[model samples]
Each structure stands twice: as C-alpha cells, then as structure tokens.
Target: MINFESQNLICRFRGIVLQSILWNNDVKSTKYTIKEMIAHHSCLELPEGKSITKADTLEDLAQLYELDDYYWAVKNIHPLTHDLNYVL
Candidate 1:
C-alpha cells in the first residue's frame, strides 16, 4: 500500500513537471515553476498577462481553469505520453 502510494505520488509529481514544461513552452514568455503555473492557472490568468494576487488559496486556485484540474487528475502518466494526454 505504501509502495502504491509512493508510485502515485511520483506519477503525480512527474505529471506536474511535464505540465509545467508544456505550459512554459506554450507561453514562450515567462518560465514558471509547477506551483506558480498552478496558481496562475487557478487565477485564470496567462503567465504573460497581468499578475494575479487573488489565487492564494487552493480553493481560489481551483476556480481558475477547469482544464488545470483535468491536468492534475492524470498527471501520473509517462512524460513521453503527456503531449497526447494534454491534447485530449
């Protein structure tokens, strides 16, 4: 059970990392950590757009983009397949 939990955590972390890479590349302007990107997405603001000071809480973050939640939901897949998963 612990192993399974660890694997899940790894998968989720990897997924976040891959998603951060994609988001960074998609914008091609500012580079953001996974946390920052998640927060930005939660605020419904582009990384290159105006700064958001309201996404301080996880619930506040949750209201930004429905897509972000979707992204986090499957963040544990292989990195090579992230592009395909992200498109769907």
Candidate 2:
C-alpha cells in the first residue's frame, strides 16, 4: 500500500524539469524512493506529459486520457494519435 504521508516530489529526469501544475509534489507520498517515483509519475510527466498513479501504469496512463481526471492533462500532449476526447 502507498504510505499516504506527505512528500515533495521533484522531477529532474535526465535533466528535464517538471513543474507540476496542481502542486502534486506536496501531496501524500504514494511511494517511498526516487526510483519508485521515476517509475510512476514525475519522470514520465516531465517529458511526455504523461504520468502514472498507484492505480495505473504507462499503458494505463493512455486510458486515463479519456477520463475526466486526466483529460485536461492531454492539452499539452502533442503528436497525439487521437482527438481531444482521447477515444483510447
């Protein structure tokens, strides 16, 4: 299970910076290690504008674009194969 304790998630992935729009950093720590963080949210979002949560993976992230919770996030994603509604 995720720790749920508060944390500061900073993304410096491959030297690319990620500034979370919603201040996701200060929220609860879903995972404990930098490796874990990279494998999920910060790293992916910085480069691809896509991130995963405890309930999702990179593949799962694709499906999220169709959901209201993640639809807005697709605004910054270019070269998308689908339309605004994502239709994934």
Candidate 3:
C-alpha cells in the first residue's frame, strides 16, 4: 500500500517532471517498463491526458500506468490488436 506522504510526493514530482524525465532518459527501456507495468496490472483503467498529476492515490497510479502502456502499445501495435483488457 502507498502511504499518503509518498503518494503526495509522487503526485508532486510527476506533476513537475515525470514525463520529461521518462521520455528524455532512454526511451526504449522506459517504454518497456511502462508496457510491463500495465501488463502486470491488466485490470486498471487508463485515463486520458498527458498530465501525471492525475494520479492522486495508488488506484490512480494504476490507471496512469495503464494509460502509459496504452500510449506505447498504440504506437507499436494496431489499435485493433491492442487489448482492451483494462478499459472501464
């Protein structure tokens, strides 16, 4: 379980530089990590938008993870081929 303080810190950090840092540092490995994270949490929802500040809790983080996976999956696979396993 994520503690409240840790969650807040995550939200703040992501809101500031999560995307920039992730995409800027080693795109291939970052994408792989995102894909794996989403695959591991196959039941999570993927919310729209580019802001990582959207995650307010562990549940929200799951959704954000899914969104990142979906974003990369769409780029790498046919839309029809991409599994909708996590869609709400």
Ranking by TM-score: 1, 3, 2
Q: Scored by Cα lDDT, where does model 1 land? A: 0.41
After the best TM-score superposition of candidate 1, give how far the Cα of residue 7 lies from its true spot, in angstroms.
Answer: 0.3
Clashing pairs in 1: 11-76, 42-64
The C-alpha lDDT values of all candidates are 0.41, 0.34, 0.41
Q: Which stretches of candidate 3 lie over 4 Å from their true place?
A: 1-23, 43-88
Q: What lDDT tens digits, residue by residue, belong to model 2 across residues 1-88?
A: 4333212333232111122212222212322233465656545445433343442432233233333334346445542553333455
Using all chains and alpha carbons, the TM-scores for the candidates as numbered come to 0.28, 0.17, 0.27
**Which residue pairs does candidate 3 place in steric collision?**
none
The positional error of residue 8 in candidate 1, measured at the CA in angstroms, is 0.3
- Candidate that beats the other on lDDT, 1 or 2, i.e. the better one: 1
Candidate 1: where are CA atoms >4 Å away? Answer: 25-88
Q: Candidate 1 at residue 60, lDDT? A: 29
Q: What tens-digit string does per-residue lDDT give for candidate 3 at 1-88?
A: 9678646644643433345232333334443444344445432254322222344332243345444553455435543333333342
TM-score of 1: 0.28
